[model samples]
Target: MKFERSEENIGNRVFKGALFVAGGRFVLRLFSLVNLVVLGRLLAPEDYGVASLAIVVIGFMQVLSDMRVNSALIAMREIDERHIDTGFTINMLRGLLIAALLFIFAGPIADYMNEPKLEDVLRVISVVLIFDGARNPAFTMYQRNIDFSKEFRRRVAATILGSIAAIVFAVLTKSYWAIVAGTLFGRFTEAAFSYWKIPYKPRISFREWKVFVSFGGWLTLSGILSYFTQTIPQLLIGKYLGASPLGYFTIGRDVAQVATRELTGPLVVAITPGLSAIAHNTQRLRTAYRKAQAVILGIAMPIGVGTALMAKELIAVLVGAKWLPATDVIVWLGPTLAFTMIASATDGLAMAKMATRAMFNRALFVAVVSTPVFGLAIWQGDMITVVYALVFRMFLQTAVNMYFAKTLIGDSFFSPFTSSWRSLIAAAAMAAIVSAVPASFTPSDPEYVVLLEMMPRVLLGAAVYVLAHFVLWRLAGRPDGFETKMLEVSGIALGKLRRFRRTAN
Candidate 1:
């Protein structure tokens, strides 16, 4: 909970923090991906369908119960015992309210969804919110200080433990309850670790509740609006299309999201605090904002494009042929993932600037616009319509988010695209090259040939993308940007490594 002020360069600190977070995600998501693929093979589609509904309901309640106090604590320039205690108090109250609601509505929700098993699952998962509420708020100080290395350790350990637990349970039971148990155990581990890591005791107070509420009021509304736009697919998909189809949609969307979410999630986590550290300086904020977006898109654009191109093979190899129906959804959702990644950093920028009301307005616009389109698609009761609607919603959401973000940060609305066009073009070219590979080159179904065929194709595709991007950067006069900075850093690191090796010899 103690804060350490670093006299380091802001950009360096941000870059290092981002590296820690991204590295952690890469490791943890590998664990999670393995667990998911294994579970996908072990459990039936109906199990995921049930788990998806429970997750949506849980997320919906969590959204309604959001106070955004942790965010306020992160954004606030000054902090005190009262402020931290009030955040804890509000969290406990929010957790209790959400738990009570879930417990009471568990059966009703199960009945409404026509899934009798959800009642017990929902009740069990409700405890997660309480654990979340009881956690110390001062742990956020680590983030505010840009000490993501510690954050990285904490999250990676918890995720590994959770993944192991989930895999064990899935192997034994092969049921949706394994998913619920994994989720609950993960939250429990995180909460317990927060107190152990931070050495802060929770206390009840409302002295600073007004301050938190003042800053977080708009954010609370924004969270609620986001649930409707974001979780609507899980909520309504089952009702219209049945659990089996919803299961297909759920897995497809989950796998597709890894393309951008795993890459950008940590950067988004790092950027809010990083941007806040320099919020007073307009020039620094603008530079940091643009770089964050560029770096995220630079990594994420190729991932989305590559994943879409290899959707069929990836589903076949990773999650198995049983999930082939999910391939179409994955392909169409790729562009949506790309669009979301481009806009991911903007929310952090807005939070740093305390533009919560502007964020609320942006969310409201997306909700209002996307809701009816999503509804009409669901009304059609077809998977293709649902995919089209989801993609359309993502595009609309991105456009609105970009406009408001520009207004808040005083950047051009087209800045993201302009900064990342090279990455986009390179990714497209790489996908084309990979896709042009003849089926004759595709090896037969033995595991070795599958790895031989898929591995080389993927590697070649990635190499082409990197080479093309670099060539394009050179042709454009090698502008001073994230890619240039990354190259410089890598070169310096490599030189140090070589010198150290020579000294050791």
Candidate 2:
């Protein structure tokens, strides 16, 4: 991982890689909004709840199969074709097994949930696991090479196609089947695009089987535990409270998750490869880890807080008033997801260091601690209680994981807080100003008119948040931060674009 003087521009490449990923996510969010808003209007909450439950089942199987082979591949100092072939062979086998399991057990799972319709949904969606398994494993090369532009294009196309499929299916059937169609189409596109985009072909080999398993075994365990921790609540809620309530819970969680999960997605994509590239240098690794957390929180914290404050208007405008029961769920989940993002981001640094044992232990602790909390929430049979349980679990998990990450990076526990406190303070100030505004935009008549009323409040809140954050950021003497780095990256990107245009001319 040592860089020669000629290769000292790694930092620049890292920034450029981040720009592509962030830009892709920016566009993908627009596609997701279209998917969510249109589908929300077309399908009932019960439809969404059923589809979501089915997805959770499929998702768990996929996670169980993910032995973290790709992550291991990226972390390695060098990986030959043998390693790649082994990873691919293992993946294909796992995919087939998971798909078969889904197909075979779909009926039993449906019976357990007491939703007979879910069996069909599970069988239909099981094909995605095969597509996922068959996808080219070479896409990690784009990440390892610090080139995300190609990855961005691949994702954007898939999202656009998937959103189109979802809308069309929703219009045609108006059943939960529409969501399943979109999910399947998206996975199939991603799997097909991988081989087309990369020069890799499927080949069966196990020459490096032990190498892959040794590195990925803990990752596989950790993935399974993490998925179960996150999804068990959805399962319990669907069983105990029924589909419509789970639908409301799911939608609310989705809206709140955008602030944390969606925003953090690209950051993780960029940073994991970047951090892996420099893992040999302890000092550099420490600095990168600290700065990354700061950047994520600086952007994510404000959005979470602001979204929490404006959940009512957001739900009314985006999701329609019939879904208003999810408002409280959104408020709590907004901050809950914020903490989860922080925890997940720190874990990425550990992954770069190959600290899977530590990572697994943390995941194990959270799973052990949170299972009862989720059970209690289900027992209470209230969506708000479920959200509160999640918030509490995330808060505890963040602290424990940060402690483990701190040990690896040799950084003090306070480093993240030092880098991130300004953003929190700024968000608080912005929230105060936005909250003081009159609550005059709530519509009393038709639900569709609520969208018109929500526009002004949303615009006002966004305007105030931006102005307040920037003013305070500057007044604090403008430390080296996400804003400064983003401007530098944008300048580099613009210069490159201009050069390309010149060459074209």
Candidate 3:
């Protein structure tokens, strides 16, 4: 599966990779939907809150410790087995270190959060990091050549199977352990699949230790700052507000994030190989980065804003009335995710150019400036105040990152307002039109009725967004961007289809 990176039709490869990854993620999200529907009912907010405690702790460790060597591998012009071994060794060492730390400090973490149940959970969840460390680093080789088949197969199969195990465990145990079980099973599956599929023996060697430290130093710093910026508010919420409210906040955030990330994250992944291929050419990389960011904003805004508009209906349909406390959380998270996701493109550009200090600065600004402000809000107000402060921080970060991204992207102003203007207007129009739909649902009626009403609004919102985009594109004299790129591909597809039909006849 490890093939030489192809220089042929890089754009097509990026598009196809995006579609392939996005398709796999789509299937994965369906399984997640099943889990949400089933688990949302089976578990309480407190159970979810407790589960978030273990997750955030592990995630904090993983993020802070990440060296991003795989990313370096993808961008490198050439790599060998020694490089792979070095990456693996670093991962394994980091995992064991994190595991030992968490094991020793689980008591203190639980004591701080005032959740006695969390200490046991953190100890058990530490096993997952071991599996994560053992994952096959060679899989990234496929991504370098625009090959996502192995990734697609392994992730989809693992998620579907893991979802089944989690549901069954939930039904039997009816505890937060089900969440822990699912995470463990998923990581184990990924680790086993990597070894089974790649058939490579990684060793405990750091022959390319200097190369890794050189490339990943800034990456590691950026990652730690990024993790702190994201997790600080959640940690504060758990400390000040308690587990139950944290549960509501996390659940709402998860649902909102899945909608935006699952759709547009693939595009970011898809563009990395292309960016790496053209890193030597400043103009092409900047152009590619700009168009990609614009597309993601255009696509994600509708998903995020529309989700905000449909928050009440979505919550009612997904989990039932018991979890209605999360409705406002989702509403706030929607627009917030829209703004924050723009940073993903800037991150990839920074990684490709090996100027990750720009990325580090992006995250560092938020972590340093926002933490005290968010802490003040947590103290003065409540969960909602903290949530609002977090949202405001992300919005500010987006603007700041845009300036950083422009420095890498060249001297042009890479403002979201300028690049994503059509999308902003289109999403606003769609939101305005869709807001007329009543958010209330009849609890006495069948659940299908809620879905039945929601179905039309979703479709109408989509139609309006597309129609608005097309009109603006035409009015702007057909600018070169994501819409143009999609159209060009569509034309090629149509031509092929027509040729095939004529030949068969």
- TM-score computed on alpha carbons, candidate 3: 0.95
lDDT of 3 by residue, 1-505 (tens): 4546867788778888888898889988988988888998899888998998889899988987888878988888888888888989998898888888888999999998889999999999999888888877877888888877778888888898789888998999998998999888988898888877486678889899898888888888888887887887778888888888888888788777767989998898888888888888888787777778778888798999988887767777777767778888889989789866665677667777888666777778878888888878888748888888888888878777778877886746555556668888888999898888665566655568888878889999999999999899899888877578768878999999999999999
Residue 183 alpha-carbon offset, candidate 1, angstroms: 0.9
Pick out the ten consecutive residues of candidate 2 with the lowest summed lDDT.
1-10
Which residue runs does candidate 2 get wrong by more than 4 Å?
1-7, 444-477, 487-505
lDDT, model 1, position 434: 86
Q: What would the TM-scores of all predictions be?
A: 0.96, 0.93, 0.95
* Native-referenced Cα lDDT, model 3: 0.83
lDDT (Cα, 0-100) at 354 in candidate 2: 87
Candidate lDDT scores, in order, read 0.83, 0.80, 0.83
lDDT of 2 by residue, 1-505 (tens): 2111122566667767777887778777888888888898999999999999999998898888788777877778777777778989999999999999999999999999989999999999999999988877777777777788888887888888888899899999999988998888888888878888466665899899998788888888888998998888788889988999899999998888765666767776777877877878889888777778777876677678767877877776677777889989888888666645564567668877888887788889999999999989878878778878888777888888778878888988777777677767766776777678776546445555665665676677667756766676688798777667756767878999999999999
List of clashing residue pairs for candidate 2: none
TM-score pick, better of 1 and 2: 1
Selected candidate, larger lDDT, 2 vs 3: 3
A best-first ranking of the candidates according to their TM-score comes to 1, 3, 2
